[model samples]
Target: MSLRTTLRVKTPPGFRVDASALLPVRLAAMSVAEIERIVLPAGNDRCIVGDVFEVSRGEATPALEAPHAGATLVIENAAPWLDRVGARMTDGHLVVHGSTGDYSGFQMAGGVLRIEGDAGHFTACEMRGGRLTVTGHCGDFAAGALVGDMEGMTGGTLTIHGNVGARLADRMRRGLVLVGGNAGEFAASRLVAGTIGIAGQLGAHYAYGMRRGTLLLTQRPAQLPPTFTGGGRGFDVFWALLVRSLAGEIAPFSQWHAASLPTRYAGDLAVDGRGEILVVS
Candidate 1:
């Protein structure tokens, strides 16, 4: 018998499916049949969950026990239009075996959203709390606000193991975002507060209009944005504490705790923003 609840993609979504309502917390008590009967919004029409997915019941294990009790929803295929996979989720585990469409973890509050493959745009948008990990590349506007929303991710840890598209972490309020590879243009634009660590190169116009936040880059940019001006000191203690906290997030950032101070630029004078951009010099 299966050990967890598995949903195999039978037909790719042609329109957006608001699957946020179908979460692990709500499916733990339902039988396989019941879970299959759950309804999900397909654009303007409604479609039964089973109509698009082949459901399989998993054998109960510690994974479904009290502390972790909740049907582990396992997705086997990639569907780009299947938005909001774990939006507003409170608990349980959401494991996507393959790539998924936009809004994969939109406004996700709690629990783990793991995608083995790539993810679409708005990944983890307005996330309040929890852990979201995308093994592959993610489209634009990741960890940022929705179309009209002012704030982006408010809390949680978003780790992207691959490259990210434009506007990464735009207007992010709070959270720890670590990108393993390169980030596109306008990365961390209009940032409010939080820490972002990037392992690879960054695109142009980095940290423009950043109000406040920390952007830790492994490689220095070709040229600093004109809106910022260099200089700030006496942050050794603060940098020490900050690096120690970030040690677990990435490897290179660990050495920063003891490394020489980076060349700090404070501005976004365009907006009179107090944010600082640190370049490893």
Candidate 2:
């Protein structure tokens, strides 16, 4: 059996709550009483966990070894006022059962963070390593740089089952981002190095200033930027390998046939100009 800790919100807070400190690995070592006493930032005021949530401990069905030693934490009845849900988490499994505010999974370095509902802006900003899955749509700047930060999402895997807002993966350095629905403007803008796959419609200025990286799209845009030029044949081997690797990921990537090659365009020539955009027909 695995140790499972649950934090159920008793009432929605009038002010935003910073829940970054309530990580799975840290809470697993504490008793219920200890957890309840933990202080969390609420707007400008501080509140103890017990004051805002009902804490409980239970045994969860056993599963294969987890990334963080099988420790699990569940945030029940999560709301949009809950910010920084799993900031800087290094290990363990954390699940948010509802919507979350901005900066969810900010700079997380390891383990798995799953959001059952929508996530606000800057989700997974500057993330280093780990896996973050959002079942619903995400607001702007998901997996992108934080304000003046030079890099975003250095490593890890981010999967969004629904639509994504603007500036997706902006300044991203390294990682894999897969979106199941449409994306807003400036997707992959200034991307340094990474792989982003979108299965739906793209907004204007997509791949605006990409330097080095790969952007995979299932739907052709209304207009391909003039800076990008068609890439001639010769990537059949790479295409085969890429399709094979994505076979296990979300559709339509998983459904792609390795034998077929996608339409390739290379540019953002305005910059280092090495990035590629592959449109699956």
Candidate 3:
């Protein structure tokens, strides 16, 4: 028998559904009947998985392996009302065929979470470790700290193929975020440590209060804050290493030559002042 489980939505939920409980690791142990009985929070009410989806089992793909005995889980016909699609998932693969609501991969520690469509706000908030990819646009606060939290994404890799909203990585302690399209304002506010790459234009007040981190931009912004200044050099070795490491990650950056160095600005001088912003020529 195949170790893959598929959940096809029978009907779009009229209210937002908290689908966090339906994780790959947990589902891999359940029988088809048991999976159907699983409960989910839908708005102010509750519903069982069988009420909204048709469950089936199929062959597993070689590309994805669970940390242990768990099998991969696939959600088909996913919609924006499905929230927390892979929250706290530790192992295994989870794929969403359509859009998802807020906190799509909240605190994910391991495994792969792939969203084929856009993701809502706080898409990967407080993520500790793992790989999360959103093929379409993402809303604000991705890889950022949640309200009342002191830290954002501590470790992980987040890749967005489309534009992103404001506060892209607020208070991020460590991680890698790549955006293929434009980014909104305050792209790396108060960033403590991490690497953020944006291939398109950046909005106003970007890198505001950034303390220690690297922000790679393919296009120069309209203006940079006065807190930042130029004259950074002697980092050819670091630039070459970075370019080589990112050569397979995203475009423009992936196409950069190791010998070419970009313009560097150091700042958010009002604070730690150790952060660096590299603008590709």
- Best candidate, TM-score-wise? 2
TM-score of 2: 0.97
| Candidate order, TM-score descending | 2, 3, 1
lDDT per residue, candidate 2, 1-281, as tens digits?
67889999996668898999999889999999999999989877888899889999987555522553568899999999999998999988888899999999999999889999999999999999999999999999999998898998999999999999999999999999999999999999999999999999999999999998999999888899989999768888888888888888888889999777889999889998899999999
Query: In model 3, what lDDT does residue 105 have?
Result: 91
C-alpha local distance difference test of each model = 0.83, 0.92, 0.90
Clashing pairs in 1: 2-58, 2-59, 3-58, 3-59, 4-58, 80-101
Q: Per-residue CA lDDT of candidate 1, range 1-281, in tens? A: 22367788897656777777667767767887998888898777888888888888765465433244354667788567677888888777778888878888898988888888999999999999888999999999999998888999999999999999999999999998989899999999999999888888999888988989888877878888888888999888877788778777645665565567777888788885688877764
Deviation in Å, model 3, residue 189 alpha carbon: 0.7
Clashes of each: 6, 0, 0
| Model 3: residue 14 alpha-carbon error in angstroms | 0.6
RMSD of 2: 1.4
Candidate 3 local accuracy as lDDT? 0.90
User: Mind sharing the TM-score for model 3?
Assistant: 0.96
**Segments in model 2 whose C-alpha atoms lie over 4 Å from true places:** 63-68
Where in model 3 is the C-alpha error above 4 Å?
63-70
